[model samples]
Target chain A: MSRLLIVDDDRVGVSALAALLEDDGYQVVALTSSAGGLEALSAGGFDAVITDLEMPGLHGLELVRAIRECSPTLPILIVTGYTNSPAAATAVAYGARRVFPKPVPYEDLLAELGAALPH
Target chain B: MPADDLERVYRWGWLPLIGGCVAVTAAMLAASELLFIHYGFADPTRLQRVLHLVRGAVMSFALALFAGWYMLRLRQRVEAARESLRAQQAAFARRAWKTEQAVGLGALCRLLVHEISDPINGLSLHCRLLERAAGRMEPTDAEPVRRIAAQLRDDTERLQGLAASYVEGNRAPGSSERYQDLSLEEIVRAAVAAHPCPEGVEIVVEAASDLAPVHAEPDRLRQLVEYLLRNAIDPPAGSHRVRVSMTNDGNRVLLAVADDGAGFEDPASVFRPFYPASSLRASLGLAIVRDVAREHGGDTRAANREGGGALLSVRLPMGERTS
Candidate 1:
């Protein structure tokens, strides 16, 4: 089973996406706080990390950079409401393997995650 | 090289020529005075010598003055040529800058079209599917199809708005009077309707029910709204929501669109023409909005929100409606 971490500030948004991803057969860990999420990522071993672009403390791009430094091969996905936004390109530049716009189709996210994760 | 050497020699030759004329004239006058005194035909008084000396001096002075005037005229012509060359260089620089901006703007427009094309094409395909299904199904069965068609239409309009704003960067030139009393709420809603918000993104509008109307060109207002909404929408994909609010403060009405997405690195540079932002869509969108606002005697400003993301506010004066 692929273990995925989901980070977002909105509770409802996180819950809905988590449910959708769960149904797609991925073991998910969702976090709203950036500090706690960073701590968890440092300690816990996650197959893939998917995070929101904008958050209170540590931004999604910062998280991606941190993840890249700690685990260079880890597949990181940046999830944002703004698709095709300049920030999307920035997130990708920061070390995100893939960036998906908000309201990402469950199947699309699943396929992206599947492709990004190492066997 | 021989011709240039000859020209240089000719240029220096004038000084000697003028000096020779002065010397010859002086000798001739001296000779004339000596002959006048020897023959006793004229007085060799101090006044007579002074008068002869003054006449030679005046003639020499006149010749030198004429040559100096001619040299100054030559210098003026050379200076004029240099001035024109400088002007041409400045004009070329301006043209190059404009060309660069146009190319950048064109790329941005192409990207906007590409981004919205998927949703618009999807909407069109869905509509076609609904139409074919409607022809083969009963009225009750077709109800769901109708709903889907409506949603597609809404999404299509949103895409169209995005495409329109993208292309509107190159609108025809016109004077400032070409304005009308426009409803801010309606324009904002139209812009929002035209952009299919990403699946997890929510666009919320907050406007006073009794907000005063503003005098503006309808198309320009729509463009402004499109720009603002585009900026608000382009953030990292997640459960982020964009809020667009409108409020009236007696003299002016304010329209603010803010996003809980990736905020700006430098909020002050947002209004500058061709200032590269986080997104190409954002750079072009803000440029368009700034143009539209200035056209209507208003201004647009962007600032980072305290918590997160960025806020863009456009304030337009509420002119009195003419019946």
Candidate 2:
């Protein structure tokens, strides 16, 4: 089973995204804080990581950078409601494989994630 | 002259008068010597008398000039002091204005974040619920369920984008891009759906069937609509009716939002930063609206509608610029 890690400041959003991913046959581990996410990563493994762009403690971009430093091959996707052209460009520049706007289309997200992960 | 004036003049004249008196006394002494020539004192020398007269004249003139110079210097000092005070007062006013703008902007940001958070939070909850349901459902049942979750996420992301744009426009180093081809009616409806008007207030939108699409940022366009709706809903007990109408004026698109509520005295001032006319405690909404319009290479204006209430109009260029 492909294990997925979801990080979001909003409990509801994390839970919702996790549910959808889980339904798609991925083992989902959802966390609401960057600290918890880092801890999870240190403890062991996740096939893919989905994170919200903006959060209170550690932002999505920083988390991605950190994950890349530890595991260069880890695929990180940023989900955000900040879908302006500039914001999107910034997210892409920050090492995010893909950026999905909030209330993202579930199928689209899943497809993108599937594509991002190595076979 | 009045007593005070006389005293000032006397104080100034005293030095000159004393010099004059000393001159007169010296002249008298020379004459006495001339008269006493037979009593062994040589006749006062012509050169001596001439020198004495010259000395007295020079001394009196110097006294008069010194006094005048002193008075002029005093006046200059007083003027300098006044100018310094005026400059300080101006500086203080400028600082106060800057501080006020900062506070107002901060409050506006807080309000905006608070408002935006609601939808984001809701979307988050829905996503979690959907996720939980997908966990227990069979593969066949979960497919459709998963699709709904994805759509919800997409919508929420759009909402976040709109909110972020609104906040970004209000900050420094604002975005420079002009308007683009976008659906004005759709953006307005989205804003309304994102933040529905108060329960009592009724919002009605009317647009020309063939209204040309406007060239503007979709997020900013939504912000303009939200601002108008917020203003319309902020009045005391009254028949709350907000009418939003759009028209294509050849090369430009005009959107008008009119409300039948407590009208404004000078609607022009509503666009001013921290405008105090409306009963709204914080006037950032109007400021934001005006900023968003200007950012899109457009303009926004507000006015008191005929009979009663206030009306706000936003104008933008339609289609691409040929030039």
Candidate 3:
């Protein structure tokens, strides 16, 4: 099983996505803060990082940049409500693998994880 | 060009005025000579005296004609200059009014986007969670809950689409509607370079180095690439890498953005304005992308890649006009 880290400032959203992903059969660790996400990321063992673009501290793009420095090939997916902004593109340039807008489809998320965490 | 036209009018005005005066002077001198010949039959002394009076009258008439011609020429020049000034002032006023309207509209859009974005995002997030919970329930119980969640999601997305339209439509009053020749490769490369890319996500550009340029609005095209790239690599879509390429067919240039990520379940719904199931529906990003393409007399389409993932392409007509 592949290990994935999910981060979002919205507690409800983080938990819900975690539950959904867990049901899809991945080893999921969900956190409501970027600080916690970063800590978990630094400890290693995560196959991929999934995060919300808009967050309280260490925003999505910033976290992606930080993660890029450590794991050059780790898959980073950004979930955002504001997909139209320049920040979306900036997130990708900073090393995010992809950006999924809010209310992501379950199957698509699964497929992306499958590709990213291919054992 | 207007100035040149006015200059031509001035030339025509002066040429006629000067020519008419010279003709009048010649006619007057001829008439004086005819009168002098007719008076030769009079007594010698009376005729001499008559000649003296005629000379004075002719001199006065000549002077008066010269003064009238000079005054009329001065008036004509003044009128032309005044008209030119008025035209310039009117143009300046129009420009100022357009600037004011654009600034006001820009402020309104910013304020509205700021106020409404957070609440809508929150609502959509919760609604998704509700739908997810509803899915795990008994079939009989889940149906209504799922229906309501779906309804709520639809409504929330409609509002989101409206907000996006407002932002896109809030163009400045005098924004350029003109198209210019643009290199697709340059724009795509720039946008890709600017976006933050995480590991395992590589953007492979497959454009021919000498591909033909497309006629397009540069800023809008840049936005289109940004939106497409974001959607292609978005984690839920499941592609770890993306390929952006360009080609030409007939009179248009085709820009294709493809991802090895999970492809769309329904390719046709991608461009619909408020369909939530489609990945591009969140902010109606795909709709706007399609609209932009259409505005340029072009078209956009989405399709499932044969192996996996998705392919989104836009066709922009070649611009023939030089800016």
Q: What is the TM-score of chain A alone in each candidate?
A: 0.90, 0.90, 0.94
Chain B, candidate 1: TM?
0.45
**lDDT of each residue in B112-145, candidate 1, tens digit only:** 4534443453354445545556767898998888
lDDT of 2 by residue, B1-323 (tens): 34455446545755655666566657765665565586664655788668767766775566667656766665565556667777999999899889756755654663555335535855755765776778689999998888888888678777767766666766545454533577788887776676646778887889988888887665556666766777777644243788889898755689998888877767767875567644554366777776555434355777887879888887765765333
Candidate 2: tens digits of C-alpha lDDT, residues A28-112: 9999888789899988779888877555445455577688888888787877655443334445665678877655656778888
**Candidate 1 lDDT over residue span A27-68, tens digit each:** 889888667679989887799888876554455656777788
Better of 1 and 3 by DockQ: 3
Q: Which number leads on lDDT?
A: 3
Model 3: per-residue Cα lDDT over B1-323, one tens digit each: 36556567555656765676667666666676677678783444776668756875686577668757776776677677779888999999899779745543443354446345546756776687788789889999999999999999899889888876776676545444435678888899998998777678989998865578877667667767777887776656667889998987665688999898878778888765554454433435665666566445466789998988899998776655343
Regions more than 4 Å wrong, model 3: A1-4, A7-40, A43-47, A52-62, A81-95, B1-70, B88-121, B134-145, B160-323
**Each candidate's DockQ:** 0.04, 0.07, 0.07
| Candidate 1 chain B lowest-lDDT run of ten | B114-123
How does residue B163 of candidate 3 score in lDDT? Answer: 78
Task: Write one digit per residue (lDDT tens) for candidate 3, span A10-111.
Answer: 776677677767766788999988889999998999999998765544556668878999889999988765554445666787788777765555467778
Deviation in Å, model 1, residue B263 alpha carbon: 19
